[model samples]
Target: MFFVTVDEKVKDAGPDDLIMEIPKLGTKIVCPTYFLVLPYEDFDYQDEDEDYLPERKYSVAIVLNFWKHTVRKMKDNETRYLPLLFHEVGMGCFKVIKEKNELRMAFGFTDDFAGDGLNIDRDSLEDFSKSVQSIDVLTMSACSPRIFQVTRKSDNPDEPVVSFNISIDECIQDVNNSRNKLR
Candidate 1:
C-alpha cells in the first residue's frame, strides 16, 4: 500500500478547487461623489493662529454639501471620528459646530470686513479672489456644480436696510466646463 505524506510547503494553502491568486476587487463609486465649493473672503479662524500659517491674512474658504449616503460611508466605513471628520469644508461652516454643539466657532468671510462694518470695495474682485484663494483649511478643496451667493445692499431710497442676492453658479459651471481649455 502506497501512502502520500502531507506536504509542508502547501500547508497554508486550502481548497485546491478554488482559484489561486484571487485578488481583492477594488470598489468603484457608481454614483460619483460631488461637492459645492463656495469662496469666502477675509476668512479668520483664530487670532493666535494667524501667524501659524504663512499664506496671508485672507484666504478662500471652501464649503461643501455632500449627499447623505456619502456621509454615511465616510462615517461608518472611514471610521473617522465625528469630532475630527468635517462634513463640510469651509470657515463659514457654522453647521458643523452647531451640529456638534461644542461651542467652538470660527469667523467667516463677508462682503466687507465684518467688525469694521466697512462695505467691500466697489471693485474688490481681486481682494475677494485672493482672499478666497488664501483660505488655509479649505484652500485645496474640489467641487462640482459650484454655486455662490453674494449679498449687496440695495440702493433704494425708501428702504434703509435692503440686500440683494446673486447667484454665481454660472461662473462655477463655466470653470468646471472649461477645466481643460484647448486654447
Candidate 2:
C-alpha cells in the first residue's frame, strides 16, 4: 500500500492532471480517472430543499475508479474512512484538515479507511477490484464524456478557474516522470 500527500503549495489541478501525477510511473488510468469529492467548506452547494444542510465541512478525496464504484454501492456520503486502492498504481485518501491558520491537504492510503463515522468492510476491497476491471474505456467515456471540463463560474466573472489544455497521454507522461511528487 502507498500514501500520497498534497499541500497548498500544489497548483490547481484538473482530473487528468491529478490522476497521471499521483499513481505508479508506468500505469495508466484504464478505468475512471477522477473522483472529485467536494466537501462543504471549500465549496458552497444548495440542494433542492433549502431547509436541509449537510453538516460535514469541506473535504475531498480522489481515489481509483474501483474505489469509486465500491463507494457508490455503499450509498453513504461520509468520506473520512474510505481507503482508495489501485492495483496497478498505489493507494491513498484525500483529506483536507485545518492547521491553525491554514487548511492542510494530503492524499495517501493506510491499513483501513478508519474513521468515527462508518465501518468499512475489508473484504469488499477485493470484490471492488474485480468488479471495476470489467469496465471498459468506452463505458467510462460514456459515463464522463468530458472528464475535466473547467469553466468560469457565472457569479464570479472576475475570478476564473484554471484549466489545462494538456492531452491525457501528455498528462500521463508528466505523471510518470513525477511519480509521487505533485507537479
Candidate 3:
C-alpha cells in the first residue's frame, strides 16, 4: 500500500490526494481549549446517579467539520465527493454571527484564547466582535452552515455569545465514513 501526508495545514484535500490512505498517520484531535466562565449559579449538571450537583460540572465545546475531495470509480464512470476528514489541521473554534438567513464565522485562533499566547482581554474581545461583521464564511459545496445562539442571564453586551454550528453535509458524511471504517 502507498501512503501520503496531506499537508498539516491543509483544510481540504484535492481530488488526487483524497483517494489514497495515509499509512502510519497518527490520529489528530482538536477540541475547545477554553470555555467562557459564566456565573456558577446559571449552569447545571447531573451525576451518574441522576442526582443534581450543587455546582455545574459541564463545559462547552465547538466542533468543526473539514472536507476533502475524493473520486471513486464506478462500473461505468467515476464520482466525486467532498468527504469529511477528521483531522485537526482544519478544525477550530469560530465566532458565529447571524443577521438573517446567513451566518458569519470568523476563525478563532489559539493565539488569542484567554490566558494563552496572545490572550485577549475584555476590551479587545469587544473590538474583535465589532470587526467580525464585515467577514464572511467561506462557501463550500459539501457543507451547509447552521448557527445556534446561547445567552446567559448575567451576560453583558460586551461578552461574546457562545454558539455551535457545523456543515450538516460534512457531519453526515463523517458518520458514513465512520460506519465504513467499522466494516
Candidate 4:
C-alpha cells in the first residue's frame, strides 16, 4: 500500500486549486481535511455616534463550502450538515474582516475540527481584500494547506467553485517556524 496526494477541485470553477480531491492513497487514517483564512474584508464604518475617531474595523469571514459545498450550511443549520464531510458546524465560507492589530486569540475551529493546518495568506492580506473580496474553496477533507475564495459560476445556485490565493504570510511563517525550530 502506497500513499498519494489528490488535489481535488472545488464545486465547479469558483473554488479551484483549493483542493477538491483526495483518493486517500493507501493505508491512510481519516480523510485529510483542510481549512483556510482567506482574504478578510475591512468594514470601516462609524456607529450611530459618529465621532471623529480612528479607523476601527471589524472582520467579515466568508467560509467556503469546500468540505462538501452546501448552500444549506450558510443559511440554516449552523451545526450538523449531512453532505458536509466532517459532521460539525460553525465558520464555513464567509467573508471575514478584522483589525490587523486586534487579532483575537480566541479560536472556533479548535472544536470538532477534524482537519489540519489553518492555512492563511502570506502576502498583503489588506490589499487582497480591498481589490478582491473573496474566492472559493472545497473544504472537502482535501483542501491543502493553502488559501482560496468562493465564487458562483452562474447566478443560479447550481454553479459555484473555489479559486486559489497565493498566501505570502503562510509561506513566511512556515519558513520562519521551521528555521527557528532547526536553530
Candidate 5:
C-alpha cells in the first residue's frame, strides 16, 4: 500500500495553492482549493521468448482537483455540466464531470485491456456513469476500506476475471457534503 504526505511548502501557501506529494512515487500534484483521491490498481505485461507475463501492480492514487470558480460556473449553468478532467492511465482513462448539482465519473478501458481478464458489464457501467450524488461521500467511500471491491460475476466464481463494485451515488454524496462544508 502506498501513502501520501503533504509537502512542507504547502503550509505557507494560500488555500488555492495546496500541493500533495507522494514520496514513494516522487511525484507532486497541485490542487486548486478542492480535491479528491481515488486508489486503483493496474497491471503491466511483458512478452519474452514467445511467452506472456502479466504483473499486477499498485500505482499511485488518482488525485482529482478542481478550481472553485469553475465549479461555481458549472452551478450557474443549470442545463450543462463541465468536464473537469480526463486522466489516462496504463490501460484506460478516467473522466470526471461536474454537473450543476453533483459530480459524475466514467471509466473506460482499451480494447486490449478488455480482451484480457477484465469483464465489464455495459449496462452497469452506463448506470454507474449516470448516477449522481455528493462528492464528499463519494470520496470518503472510495478511501474507506471494503467500500469498493472486485467481484466475479461469471458462472465460475473462481475465475480471475472480475468487475469493480462501484457505488457512484455514494461517492457523489460524499463529495457534495464536503464541498458544502468547505463553503
Candidate 6:
C-alpha cells in the first residue's frame, strides 16, 4: 500500500513537491510515486507444472515521476493526458519472500537505454534489505531510459531476463534526502 502526503504550505505544488510515505517505514519519498499490483494468476501462461508457477501471490511495481511536460495535446475538444503527463525518472519491483523472511526490492531504470547502469554490492543490498524487512515492504527503482531485448549466455540461452541501470544505493540516498527535507 502507498501513502501520499501533500504539503499544504506549498501553493500550487507540483508533483515533486508531494511526498510519498510508506506506512511503518518512516522514510519520506519526495518523488511522485505510483504503485501497480499484479496477481500471478492474472498471467495467461499455460504451463502445466505447478512448480513453475511463481511463489508470490502478487508483484508490486513502483513508478516515480520527476518532471512534467509543458506541452499538452488536444484532440477534438478532448485533452489526452497520458505518457505526456509526467517524466518517469525511475521504476522498480517489490516482492515479499516469506521463506527467507526478507523483503526483496530490485530497482533499475525505466528502460535499459541512456545512462550507464549502477552496480550494487552485496553489503549494500543486505543493509537495505534488512532495513525494509522490519515493515515487510519491498521497494525498487531505476534511473535509466528505454527498454530493449538482449540475449544471455546462461543455462537457458533462449530465455530473456530484464536488467536495469540504477543502483539501490542511489535510491536509498534519495529517500534519505527526502526524509530530511520532511523533518
| Residue 160 in model 2: lDDT | 18
Best prediction by TM-score: 6
What are the per-residue Cα lDDT tens digits for candidate 2 across 1-183? 222223332233223333223222222221122222222234333342331111210112322333334333432222222333222232333332322322222333332322322112345544333323122211111222243222222354233122122332343343333333432
Task: Output the worst ten-in-a-row residue range by lDDT, candidate 1.
Answer: 27-36
lDDT of candidates 1 onward, in order:
0.20, 0.28, 0.25, 0.23, 0.26, 0.26
lDDT of 4 by residue, 72-175 (tens): 12232122211112212322332322223111111012122323222233222222222332233333243332333222233433322222221324323433
- Segments in model 2 whose C-alpha atoms lie over 4 Å from true places: 1-17, 21-124, 138-144, 148-183
Root-mean-square deviation (CA) per prediction = 25.5, 16.8, 18.8, 18.6, 16.2, 21.4
* TM-score of model 3 (CA atoms): 0.21
As a whole number from 0 to 100, the lDDT of residue 38 in candidate 1 is 12
| Candidate 2 TM-score, C-alpha based | 0.23
- Candidate 5, which segments miss by more than 4 Å at Cα? 1-89, 110-149, 152-183
Q: Report the C-alpha displacement of residue 77, candidate 3, in angstroms.
A: 44
- Residues 74-150, candidate 3, lDDT per residue (tens digit)? 11222112211212223223444333323332323222223322112334333333333232222222121222122
Count of steric clashes across candidates, in order:
6, 10, 0, 41, 18, 7
Per-residue lDDT tens digits for candidate 1, residues 31-94, read 1011111122433333433331212111111111111111223321121111111113322211
Candidate 4 has a TM-score of 0.17
Residue 107 of model 6, lDDT score = 20
Q: 1 or 5, which is superior by TM-score?
A: 5
Better of 4 and 6 by TM-score: 6
For residue 19, model 4's alpha carbon misses the true position, in angstroms, by 24
The order of the candidates by TM-score, greatest first, is: 6, 2, 5, 3, 4, 1
Q: What's the TM-score of each model vs. the native?
A: 0.15, 0.23, 0.21, 0.17, 0.21, 0.24
| lDDT tens readout by residue for model 6, 1-183 | 233333444333233334444433333444321111112334333433332111211110111221011011112222111111112332232322221211233222232211322112333223322333222122222222232112223453222222222233343454445434433
